[model samples]
Target: MQTLYLSRLQHYLFCPRQFALIELECAWEENVYTAEGQVMHGKVNSGGHDTRGNIKSVRTLPLGHKSLALEGVADVVEYRTDEHGVQIPYPIEYKRGKPKSHRADEVQLCAQALCLEDMHNCKVTEGALFYGKTRRRHAVTFDEELRALTLEAINDCRYIIESGITPKPIYSTSKCRNCSLKEVCHPKIFNKNAKAWLSNQITANLNEVRQVNNNDD
Candidate 1:
């Protein structure tokens, strides 16, 4: 398996086509929304680790697993030491937007957890997602379900990237409205193909009936 970046999971969840376009095709277009996100992440990514008492706040921590062929950097990690001097790793991800309706954010956070677990050999049971809009932290538990989802997403992303073919655009009013590639994707154009196919089927059936009638005459 090729090495995958943890960020790919976020892109995959946002829109698989977008994920492929960026990662596979090396295509990128920065909008105001993305620009704001980059600015917000810069603050977190630029800071160095700060140790206070038994807790250490590390920023832009590089994490990866060669075995799984995955790698990425975490925005922040709170390494807490217990009374016995055992260290616990907790990942924190910063998001520019408010909480979304889907598990895309959670999947991204969980991928960070997986990377931390692999690199540190520590059990990371949870992580946090800090929303820039709300200025609040949402705790994400890295349970079996979430971990499974994350791994599944990685596999799906690998398949998509390996295939090197973008999936057909799904005609979704809600998704298309917010998609950056809406104009390029032209979901309506693909939708018309469906209607066109139906029309062709109708015409073919009519022609077949006419041939049978002509033979009978």
Candidate 2:
């Protein structure tokens, strides 16, 4: 019954090993991309308030769903009055990059919406992702497909965290291209025969050192 961090849904979608390393093993590193994202989220998490007509923007709202065992802070939850004049939560997540070819971000946002719906006892039809690169918000409808994917991700994350088993890393052009854990995860080596490769490399380096010593003698 380990509770899953709502934010880690995207990380799990990107790579389960990355998720396990961060959540389970407590391993983390900061690259340029991660740093930028951290800064953005930090700013968002500082807490702010903005009001526009029927919309009230609230930053850093703590959300949790007991049934799903999901807990995290939403970057911004806009309380907007709908046509029915009822204020409903609309979550907006901040990211450092542009929209990717995958639905990881969408799934994360949808998960937030699900949390909001459960917490508020209302229906959330959509949320959004504000990409720094685009400098705009992209709306995401919480369709059935996206909801299913989000739920699946939650279950998968729970399984990984409960088992405390880190999955093997696989090199991905998109997922691992700018991953901060690339060096620690060692996808290229571990995906193949890492033990054998390391052994050969160590032996070769030793032989070269021995040859150099012999020449010196």
- Global lDDT of each candidate: 0.86, 0.91
Q: Would you give me the overall lDDT of model 2?
A: 0.91
Give the number of colliding residue pairs in candidate 1.
0
Model 2 segments more than 4 A misplaced: 194-217
Candidate 1 residue 93 Cα shift, in angstroms, is 0.3
Tell me, by lDDT, which candidate is best: 2
lDDT of 1 at 49: 88
What TM-score does structure 1 among the candidates reach?
A: 0.85
Per-residue lDDT tens digits of candidate 2, residues 14-56? Answer: 7889999999999999999988998999878888889999999
For model 2, state the Cα shift of residue 195 in Å. 6.9
Provide TM-scores for the models: 0.85, 0.89
Task: Please name the candidate that would achieve the greatest TM-score relative to the true structure.
Answer: 2
Task: For candidate 1, write residues 101-193 as lDDT tens digits.
Answer: 889999989988888888888899988999998999999999999999888999899898789888766687776776666666677675567
